[model samples]
Target: MRSRHPLRIAAAALLAFATALPLAATAQAAQPTAAAGGVLYKKINSGVSPSWYTPEFERRLLASGTDGVRLPADATLPGGVTAPQAAGLVQPGIRPGQWLLTLLGSDGSDNLLGWCSANFVFKKNSTWGLGTAGHCGVVGQPVSAYVVPPPASGKLPGLYVIGKISLSRDHGIGDDFAMITISPEFSSWMNPTMPVWGGPAGVHTGDQVGEPLKHFGHGTLIGTGGTPRVGAALRWDIENGAGYSWAGAATPGDSGSGVLTLSGQAAGDLTHIVADVEGNMIGVAGTRMTKILQVAQGWTLVNGSLLPL
Candidate 1:
């Protein structure tokens, strides 16, 4: 496997995503474009520096339960193992958001992978859902939000393995991504919660590579402090075409967070894998408020303003 930085992952993914959109969606797509990074909270430790690595490296970011970032400039992930194979396998803690979700049964039991988590779309009537990496949520399985915590908290921040998970018809492995459909029941759990502190982070789209953007989320599972919508925020002009910031990319635990820009504008949600942060890359952004509208059971313009989904 070839190694990749998070930035490269985001860029490469976009290339594939554009090429593989469902025929219906592809018809609506504007065209292939360029982009860059920035995300929520702190970056996850991942234990490995390179967000993406080669199978031959063997120096994975985790020891078990989900370790390692997968990427390379020209090769697919999990294809490298050159790292000190044995030494790179250290167990990392499972935090929601970044942890890959898995489901075992539909008994409504917490049978999903402890490492999985989700970023849901809160809605009324409890019919909310979210979009996540395709590999995690598939046809007939449950989605995992957070692994069983150390038991110290007795509570995790994501959904439990209670029901079925649905993916977007556009999902693709060759694209290395997926969209997750959740239930409104899962939205209730994240009520009155914004995950990180500061302000009501929002999401916006139709942005140019040079347009300004901001992000917010827990620094990966590594435990880091979050920054408010203040200070000299990084610009979204680093990569190409149109891009976000690299330093602000989300970490392991920030999978489903939103990426809103200042001025209460929706830039895009921290949806997919943002690129170029710590290690190989960082931010892996996906859809923002615009897409959120697609799955949002309902919508309301709070204070005459569209809230970031």
Candidate 2:
């Protein structure tokens, strides 16, 4: 079981934005009868609520931490996995249209693991259409990926998959990381209209320090994300580092989770989604929404579901 290129995993909009700012940059899978990645990687802690937390986001917390919360794990490498991959482990508090990520193995060979949350969407019939960096979907390239659905969710059940990604270009996978549509039958257990963190739709997605954020998972209660409200796209010293957060902080297993406002509004997906999946923050993952939809393998938010727009 190999994982997606660790080196390439860090290739996304975060890198491009970080480069422009003269700041540094940042940074799944599964089994069904078996443990696909997302099932095992559960959020153990509670996301901290930043003062900047907006009502818009707090709404997302509506059903967070209830039951069925788990994180997806990647089976590519030798446990060289994403710490935040656990988001899928615990049942999310929200519904469909929630964001989800499928962590793959090192070599992109199989449907090993995955991670997902309220802000993401889990699609079906994606054998020919798995998830990949938005940039991975080139105009003329043949992009085939992997997918795996999560086990039956007692509460907010849904489909999941570990994506085996293949990119046609280097940066194509970035900005436009892509995920195809899922079938409604497999997407039954979970809803498609609730706030991922308990917030409403079309909430603020961009913000800076002193802002509020929160993470809700399984590892620890209040033992999760949502910290001091760090700056958005902070162009820091590449020499010292970039986007280093003293605030808007996070803990392990909080990776790939969306950062919401205290109001429960969906703010932005955490970058590199990991604080230290390895040990340091130098190499983490970041999700680029704007670019994610620009790819040939389009993405859409339909009736709260993220499908091929």
Evaluated against the true structure, the overall lDDT of model 2 is: 0.30
Measured with C-alpha atoms, the lDDT of residue 31 in candidate 1 is 20
Candidate 2 lDDT tens digits, 149-171: 23454433322332233332222
Q: Model 2 residue 203 lDDT?
A: 40
Estimated TM-score per prediction?
A: 0.42, 0.38
- Residues 7-65 of candidate 1: C-alpha lDDT, one tens digit per residue: 43444443454333322221111122333233221212112122232233322222222
Highest TM-score, which number? 1
Q: Best lDDT goes to which candidate?
A: 1
